[model samples]
Target: MENKKELRNWLNKMELAHPLVIAGPCSAETEEQVLNIAHQLKDTDATVLRAGIWKPRTRPGNFEGVGALGLKWLQRAKNETGMLITTEVASPTHVDLAQKHDVDIFWIGARTTVSPFIVQEIAEALRGTDKPVLIKNPVNPDLALWLGAVERFYEAGVSNLGVIHRGFSTYEKTRYRNNPEWQIPIDLQNRFPDLPLILDPSHIAGRRDIIFDLCQTALDLNYDGLMIETHNDPDNAWSDAAQQITPETLDQITVDLRIRKEEGDAVEFRNKLATLRTKIDVVDHKLLEILGKRMKISDEIGKLKKDNNVAILQTRRWNEILGKMILEGEEQNLSEEFVLRIYKAIHQESINHQKKVISN
Candidate 1:
């Protein structure tokens, strides 16, 4: 990964406003569709026009992009609108074709980012090119894998790099199409302070109604920009229609989003914030100590279970504990969702401890 200074230099070269927006359809259905949407997004906050030329859908028999032909449409759109063009590249061939079409930027989709071999191949293809490359986080919330992909690109002499947090897939039903495990990206930002971290709100939201709110949250979290899926007629779009929005709606979202300052400039505000942060530090330390003690007790229970030849996962007992905790958490002003996530993690750790004891 590039250092903060090097990443800052990359950002400076882009010369973008505070939140650089990249907007276009999820897929390039046709030349007219691509060009029309590009025209609509021309005056918006969007600086880059993006469309998927080679979409890798989960299921077969879907409107997988317009193939290499779409690159020409993207080129035409760029010529007409004067907007930089970007697209998802899954292979070395994609990189070659995109370079041939003079595509301004390239991003690796979540599916492609998960595979080291594919990333390496694409990185090899882009070895000498200085075009900006944005890598989406893997389908699963694996930070190490995501970081590895970025490092692979960086090692391959790709200096102009960025990351896209498109959220992570989960089997459980959620309000979101993918769970916006915001902490993963926030942790990434903490690790690489200068890395350009963009959020894909359309994918996270899965519905137009919540896109604006998701974009606002991302900006509030100090995200570098947003990549919203835009289309002329989203309701009848080829794929991911529910998540795509019209360019007019994209304009409104960008206009209404309030970008926040990274930190307060006032001395009093800084001093007060530091004091509050110290208090939080103390509370967090205490919380960790308590969790450590709980885990130690869990280890003891694991030993006892092993001695008694009892299974580690007592489903009935776990259900009872979860039920009790949810009610008690409500009294303590904690949401059931929050309590469940915490306990689920703790229970997994307890199971791991039991497994170790049983193995021994």
Candidate 2:
């Protein structure tokens, strides 16, 4: 994985006029159902049809996918519509089965990506594969784990690679079904600009209403493509019905979503952009300087607490600071979520500093 840029070779080979759209039902319910959705999406922006033949649900007795039988339906759909087909492969057996069915592409699910052993098994199973394989981010927000999964596949000599950002699981209640920690994917994209980055907004939104917004955000950030779960009858879909949209809705969403330019063309635009970026750099520098000062103050406080034989953690004070910061953050047009994440990181760093002082 030394040259992550090579991951884009498969995508570049396609030379698609529009962003790659992989759309289909969450699970392949039946041959008729699969073909019905495929025919509908065939006219849309969707370049690929995706389905789950063996869904590994969080719990049992919840329609654990149609198994290998569903692959037949996806094959039929591909034969009829001539669209590229993809499916999730959790194990080596799945890899063999999907290859047998001639699945055009393969994706590793979030749950599978969480486990190194499973990823290794699948990667070995897919060794020397010429077809594209997409790796989804892990269920939790662990970028290292996600990268490790990708590297495993790469090490196994599967160079045709891409990644899906399907958001991350969080206990906190929010409008989203999963927390869209945008920075994680952004960081990945920053480090490996050529690595294909696709966003699975269906899982992130968990409802049809906000899928458009999420897709728009991804396109605005220059995502390579999107994977949306779409069904002919979304409300009555067998699995993940809440997140599934109708093919018509998916078509409209693609039409409505805006894709912004990555860079300016005109000199005037470039000058303005450069000026704005300079201001951001200056602000970022100031923020780091302020953090340095804050850490110094934290070190002094840690020394005083050590001399007084007091514990490093002051839960009540931390809560009060967080509450006040949230209110002040609102006035500055900073979200409570942003304030919370920033302060939490700072607090952890302060604790680390205090720990060092206590140890000495």
Candidate 3:
């Protein structure tokens, strides 16, 4: 691991065509898939090719991954194309294998990022190695946990540190598969001003159609790179079909992307970002207080509805609230659509509380 000064100097000297892309399939499904994409992307500016060798899926009986054998295929891709290679390392053994195979970069996935024990183990494995390691945010939106994982990697002596802002898992139904809380990564950059940050549009959008827009938005926010999933046949991909793009699609996206400068000194921009975040913190606290009051009122409503044996789904009341809130949001320059979505969630929770009260 590089110390902060060493890492900054390395990033500065890399001469990356701002917004360096690092793309490949979600998993190296086969050698053919890896090679085909590698051939297609050979002339492109992607600094590293990423693929999942050990996919940790939630359910059993699904396509877990090709395992350690896939590492050989990645090495082959690097040998054939002369491009750098990267893969996710979930365990100390994974670290050992990747190091043994001369894998250029290793990323800690969101699933592994959530567990301090796993992060520490991986860190320990990487203690003597100088491999460039990227840490993705945790599956949930826990900033402290994410930072801790990065700090661990740094403590372990890995200097080429970076972060992949792949969005966060949430219960809300969003157009995005993962909520692109752009603010979270921005907050990260504010604290670690020298840290390189990349965006994983594939995981965040979770649909090919939205990857372009997400990439554009990440660029607008001055992210350092993109880690998109590109497969030869997205529709027939073995895993995450909706999120995978064809190599042709990724090629088009690269052509279409516009990289932006940070507008000013990186540190200055981060300080400004911090000021905006401080404002968000104040507003968020007030919003939570209001939500607490609203829940209290909801409890009262629940008691009344239970006493009257009324069903929790009061369509008329919901319609009124939605209408009023939408109008109010528009007046305040908030996206009416966004406000409606938030209120709908709050309303659903209120209904759930009422139902529970009625049942008990």
Candidate 4:
């Protein structure tokens, strides 16, 4: 594995004053469409132009990209617009073809990242290359699998690595099409601090209106860049129409988003932040202490239950606790979702404690 300093060479080489922007249509609909968007984006902050050539769709007969023909379109767009071109590569054939077409960057889609066999194959195909390969997080929110994909590339001697947080697949319907489990990428950031992290708000929002907000949030979280799907006409785009935005809208968005400084400029601000963080540390310590005491109480309750041969899980009690805590959380300015998540984990831990005692 490349050390931290060696891993960050690509980013250092860019020396961009602003975040790197990668923008283009989701899929190359036509030569005209690709070139049109590319022309519009070339003037904007986007340094890299992207178009999906071989889209991995969930089902068949659903317009699975224009194939190799799209690569020529992307190449032509790059030439005309003077922008770096990128495309998603799924198989070894895709890799070989992308290299032939002089694709500047390669991105491993979420679907391809899921399978070790495919990732390894593509990694080996891209072995010892200096191109910045951006790997999207797997379809599911598995950090291990995502890191595994990065590992495969590193093992293949590909060092110019980065990641795209395109969100993840989930059954629950929410505002987002793909749930932006932000913590998963944050965890990856914790492990590989040098890896350039980019946000694909286009996939996460699945709507044009919320793209700017997502982009702003990403910048606030110290994301290195964004990969937004831009088309000449978003509503009538070939694929992922809901998520795609127009080139004009993208231009406005790039202008509107703010890039905050990582560190406070003033000594006053630094002192205030340090004091606040110290308070947080104290509160965190107290929270742990209280949770430890609660667990000890749970242990006593488990012993009592064991003597009477009582079941560990009391669904009625859990529901009551959940309902009550949710109401309390709302009073304390916490969301119901946050309360439910916290309480559910506590309830599970309590159940485990009881199970251990009862089994003994």
> Estimated TM-score per prediction?
0.75, 0.75, 0.74, 0.75
lDDT (tens digit, per residue) of candidate 4 on 85-184: 9999999999999999999999999999999999999999999998889999999999999999999999998888888999999886778899877767
Candidate 1 lDDT over 224-278, as tens digits, reads 7889999999999999999999988888888788765546568556544654564
Per-residue lDDT for 66 in model 3? 97
Winner by lDDT between candidate 3 and candidate 1 = 1
Q: In model 3, which range of ten residues has the least summed lDDT?
A: 1-10
User: Candidate 1, which segments miss by more than 4 Å at Cα?
Assistant: 1-14, 261-264, 267-360
CA RMSD, predictions in order: 9.6, 9.8, 8.2, 9.7
Model 2, 58-96: lDDT tens digits are: 988898888999988888888998888999999999999
Give the CA lDDT, 0 to 100, for residue 347 in model 4. 82
Predicted structure 4, TM vs. truth: 0.75
lDDT of 3 by residue, 84-188 (tens): 899999999998898888898899999999999999999999986766788999999989999999999888877778899998998867677887676678788
In candidate 3 the C-alpha lDDT for residue 354 amounts to 79
